[model samples]
Target chain A: MKLKGVQQTNWIGVGIFVLIVLIFPFVVTQSFLLNHATFTGIYVIVSLGLGLLMGYAGQISLGQAAFYGVGAYATAIMTTTYGLSPWIGLIFSIAIAALLAYIMGYTMARLSGYYLAMATLAFGIIVHSVLVEWRSVTLGASGFYGIPSINIFGYTITQGIPYYYFVWAFAIIGIIICLNIVHSRVGRALRSIHDSEIASSAMGVETGKYKTQIFVLSAIFAGVAGWLFAHMSYSISPSSFTLDASIIFLAMVVLGGSSSVWGAVLGTVLITMIQVTVHTLGEQFTFITSEFEHVVYGLILVLVIIFMPRGLFPTISSWLNNKMSQRSSETQEKKAS
Target chain B: MLEVKNVTKTFGGVVANKDVSFSFEEGQIVGLIGPNGAGKSTMFNMISAIFPPSEGEIIFRKQRIDKMPTNAMAPLGISRTFQNLQVFKNMTVVENVMVGRHIRTKTGTLRAALKLPGTKKEEVSAYDKAMEYIQFVGLQDLYDHLAGNLALGKLRLLELARALATEPKLLLLDEIAAGLNHKETKEMSNLIEKIRNNGTTVFVVEHDMDLVMSICDKIIVLDQGEKIAEGTPREIQSNQRVITAYLGAEVEKNAQ
Candidate 1:
């Protein structure tokens, strides 16, 4: 009982995606490449959550990295200090993030545009400050170390190859769940609210309730992604999850299509690849400084906003679909006439 | 039936609706007409539960509904089209209508997440109903068009279709004829009558005196948040207070 035309295509795409991800590790043996792919997967999961909140739900959040940091810190603290299992820490992290998100969302949901953005920005900054100032527990600016590797059912994912599979598996699961939510009634309600809050309310969509639910759900996803990252990296610093990281996450949402799930994945992969490549080039080329990379990134962001406001995925997909449909309609009309 | 009793709404110190009382019976087309600042739209807002009246009570289907949120009022079979055409601009015409059907849906979020049988069936039915309303409003040709791209007249039609898609027992229309051409206004008035004929009461706030005079079963005139006259359209047309409040005392004297 799926939506007839698009549903079949989506399932086919998912199948091909599963196949590609499953075979990816075999093709790439380099540790750096594997590590990059794992990081991409983690970002993809978090970005997909952000995309759902911003793109479909019409919310602007600059606090995603805060939730991500919360998850990572919670998992790290739970595993190291409490001597708990990483898996248990993962669950606890998601719960804590969701609880915090629920409280924040209740207050933040009523705000729109610049106000909402500012509130979330403040939240990310606050989280980053806490991580730095709380020295005894968090180890402050030096960052936390000795985070134990994740063990799933007696399988220790300590190295690149095993960890790559683990992160990607979680990413694929995250993508599937996000896809389901996007196509569901909840997604429709969100889109409605995004378009016109008053109209959606008049239609009996409890706007506040739905907003909070999506916010909390997105936080949980970010938390889970953080847990994966913390365990895989075996180290995390407050600097890694700052307001700048939150902006990067938001950039991924905008660079991909905000409303599309695959856009989140594509955006994460492209941005990470670009960052890694540019950093590598900076080491070789004397002129290619960190400042130059920042300039380039800023320029690209401006260009995307001006020309492809819907993001790369939506623009490409719509263009391709438009051409295909045009050909089909022409053929059908020719036959009819 | 919908009843508004001694409803008073004040925005800060300014009174928008003061001691206004009215009731609409089932299967009736009631025209709420007033000049500028007569509080017609404010009274409509109060009836639709957009904001609670500062004083007094609103009863719909024999239930006190003034305290309910606007979102919660849709399930009780009350729906409204906004004065400025509040169609979901990002959505297609059909999707805008489908949102109206959301209240009737029995699917829980978890069930929707899992794509359960209940949600699947409900989704299909909701789409079908949306299509029906789109056709009812004569917008079937533009069913898949994004509401934002539609012309002003079409957007109004889309808003009406969306409100109708809720399967409402009573529909409130605020300035539905405000921007329409003469022909479009006539068509709108006829369509509203047809909707009323289909066992739904219609309460419309209109500035078009011609449409109100021709189509309304009963007319309620307000002046500065006070009910000046309530009767058949002919009675309202001849009412001295309504003429004085609407057309000025000089115009009323000339008419007499």
Candidate 2:
């Protein structure tokens, strides 16, 4: 009974997700929905990493898409050119991304706020340019094509349903790992550093080391997601993993609330759904164009930043709890009268 | 025991401390009295390993600690409170103290992540220690309050509690009695004495002459980055150079 409340809520969330994932193929029966779900799962993985970095650690990283791209490009090159297994490439992607993250984090951890953001933004742009200009490796503007689908135990997951299960498996693992990290000692240190780096360091926390570790860990998560993305789509493009994509990932983290891992999943799912729906609507109504989606996104970001800076989950959860408490109070008052 | 040998620190061309050498025996409350810009805080910072001294050695229980980083120094049983009050504002009062105990925590990041049996036990112990420290600082009632929301006096107490939670062998208190009423200063002086009685050597940098004179077993005076005098409080009160440099001729004449 002590854990009954938490268990009930968790079960409710898990049940809804299970129903949706199971019934979605039957209801839609379209390749578009399957694609959207795959993309949504990828975003979920990346957003979870971003959430841990920005929300918990209080480090705004604009270079996560760069790491994501790094994973994709690394896997693409290894698999296509060297004929390496995608699984091996996935491990290497994490290593390379983690190494890059360590260097960047060490340099940028000392910088604060806008300066830190600018540093990461510059890094993202540099990576994007490298992807565009590196002809032999990334295939430049022609893009890397014919990435082999993920193969597990000699079974090629070439279809949407199989790929959906793969993406969901990794997404769930990523979420669980992030949640565990959030409640750990490192998590406490990250929160303290976010509040005041000086105070944290003075309290005998190796502030710089912890920040760098989190940065690298988050990058590894992003890299894993990128690996999944490349394998799922069976294609890679420089355009998809641009600075704009990085911004979209950040928006997902902020919109869903950076404070909780569940927020990351909710945010990714919500944003992906909106994007798919908007694209469909744009096809029907010529006036509702793809360009307008950015405007809508910008407006939503502004509203969230202004009204609910703690993010959607904390805000919504508190409101619901408050209403429940009020209703209970009213019932008690009536019984007493 | 704590010893600083020929500690010299310079910020670019400006010399902050020059050949500052002193020793504090265990169980003694030593007062470092200095005028503004007297390198009192600079010395404290160096001793606490916030920054390495330009040329010198810091020996704590005969172990050189000058090369150690601030974080590592805590586990070496050295702790300090900032002059500006470096309490973690976003954390609760108890959590602020828990940060001090972080070095002693046996739980690894992985164990903490998994919420394993070892980590859970450590967590319970840490909470208990934090509560004990809160009570030690007479902040039991406000243990749940955010440190930033507390009053200035309470914040000072919180900083003291946090530092104490490190279970330090040597405590460096920078301007602990700087902004307090007469009664509060007296209480703080008593608290410093209590801290000393608990087997922790204390080095306090304070401007309140009355509190310093009453609490300190020995007094070291600095003026413009140099040690002007070092002796008993009565001897320091009578020293002509200390009078001229700090209290002035008028105060010396009044004392006579």
Candidate 3:
């Protein structure tokens, strides 16, 4: 069956991916590239959750970066302003983001398609405004600073390589959790909802309940990424959590293939590399504008939508499968001869 | 075990079903046949809780379920296929059936994502159970095939298998024989008989008179959004009003 062959190839791909992840830090010793890789790991965690929502559940949210910001600001305020432990701040950050998602999703989950997109877009704008306008709590646009690094067992992971491994550890765990959800009953129900909400409800799937739950779960993932990012950068800023970041996260999920978690990781890495390339190119070519990144993102989004709507991973995998099957059949014909 | 108490459904200015009532005991293959726009599908939808009746109640095993949501009906042992074929097109045959086991299993989203011991164990059993229904509907060979790739006949059977996966006490089949060739229609009728013999109270809405006549233990006929007749197949065939409904008053009089 095609199932077994596809699964075997997937395991092999995972093996190769693991090897690359382990060797990436050592081979790329430059802090500039390593910095991008570290950020890619953090974004992978967030995009994995978005993949479940948009890819599997067929729901869209344009406000994920708001949750990310909420997590960073929550932890920043908790640890720096209130003198709470970083662990406590981490929990608060995750809880606060999840709570906000639950409250918004309670009413917003009923909307579908472009309406839902517009609703979440408004939500992103509101959250971004709060980050800028709420001067007393968010420190306005000057940004919050001096946040303590995460300490585990009295060891601080301050170095670039150490934190890179740390960030990837959480991203790996996030991937495992997302894959579990994708394969389990909940995952199937979400996909069924994606395919046909009427049929899904007829099959006894509580669509509204599942939609809200996945929204909360996605927010939880974004919160974790934000917490890691806050500690990694040691600073929180409103500019980092703008609508553009949300669009980038969306682009990553779309480019990686929305339905697959591994695709999200691949998308995150590809998009991060593209960003670094754009930045480097902009510096080298003074003619290139600072706004070139958005232009490139827009072009990629439009091209991917037109050419590979299912995303890169599924398209490439299916093409590979077709080639292998053709070769196998030719071999069988030769044997018959 | 199911009762439709004077169910009446209206859409704006049009009354689709007017004061229609019917009830059936468990383990009987009951058929609902009607001409087009005769409210057969509307009655089925109301019983499946797709929409609440305008001025009536639906009772399943003595509990009022008219006000309940559609998804809640499955847990209460009422599952239905659709007239337009509501198969999950993107899912595989087995995955589509497995989703029908949603009410049967109780693993929440968090526990599933965590992949706890209980979730894994429940998944295995759910898979086995879903396979049982898939094989019951003769789709075991194509279990891995995506539903979108299946033909119209196979899609109908896939919908049946999915409904069976819910393990319902009452199964509602909406035009299960539609768009099938002669041989495929015969097989569908046989499958319906087997489903009824297996102890599911089958409630089918069909336009295929031959399939209904051969398989249904009792038949209910609707015309102009009202119950025109209800009896055994033999009784329904000779009933004057039923004949008139299907063949017009002149044909009924001429037959007499």
CA lDDT of each candidate? 0.86, 0.81, 0.87
Question: Which residue segments of model 1 deviate by more than 4 Å?
Answer: A1-9, A329-337, B12-14, B181-187
Q: Using DockQ, give the best candidate's number.
A: 3
Give the residue spans of candidate 3 off by over 4 A.
Answer: A1-12, B250-256
Ranking by DockQ: 3, 1, 2
Candidate 2 Cα errors over 4 Å, as ranges: A1-31, A106-119, A153-159, A314-337, B12-15, B54-57, B106-117, B180-187, B243-246, B249-256
The digit string of per-residue lDDT tens for model 3 on A1-337 reads: 1231011124466667777888999899999888888999999989998888888867888989999988889999998889888899899889999999898888876666666567778888998999999999999998889988989999998959989999998998888788777877888888888888888888889998988898888899999999999888877889999888999999999998986778898889899988898889988999777688888888988999999999988888779979998999999999999
- Give the per-residue lDDT of model 1 (tens digit) for A1-337: 5532112128889889989888888998787888898899999989989998888777888989999999999999999888899989988889999999988888876665666567778989999999999998998988888999877788788777788888888888888877777766677788888888888888888888887788888899899998988888789999889887898898888888797889888888888988888888999998887777567667777889999999999999989989999999999999999
Share of reference contacts found in each model: 0.56, 0.38, 0.72
TM-score of 2: 0.86
RMSD of each: 2.6, 4.0, 2.0
**Candidate 3 residue lDDT tens string, B1-256:** 9888888899999999999998889999999998898999999998988889999888999999999998999998999999898888878888888899999999888897787878767877887888888888898889888789999999999999999999999999999888999999999999989998888999999988999999999999999899999999999998888878887888867767
Of the two candidates 1 and 2, the one with more favorable DockQ, higher being better, is: 1
Residue pairs with backbone atoms closer than 3 Å in model 1 (clashes): none
Candidate 1 at residue A310, lDDT?
Answer: 91
**Model 3 pairs whose backbones collide:** none
- Cα lDDT of candidate 2 equals 0.81
Candidate 2 C-alpha lDDT tens digits along B67-157: 8877777888888898898777867787778777777785655565556776656656777888888888789899887788898888888
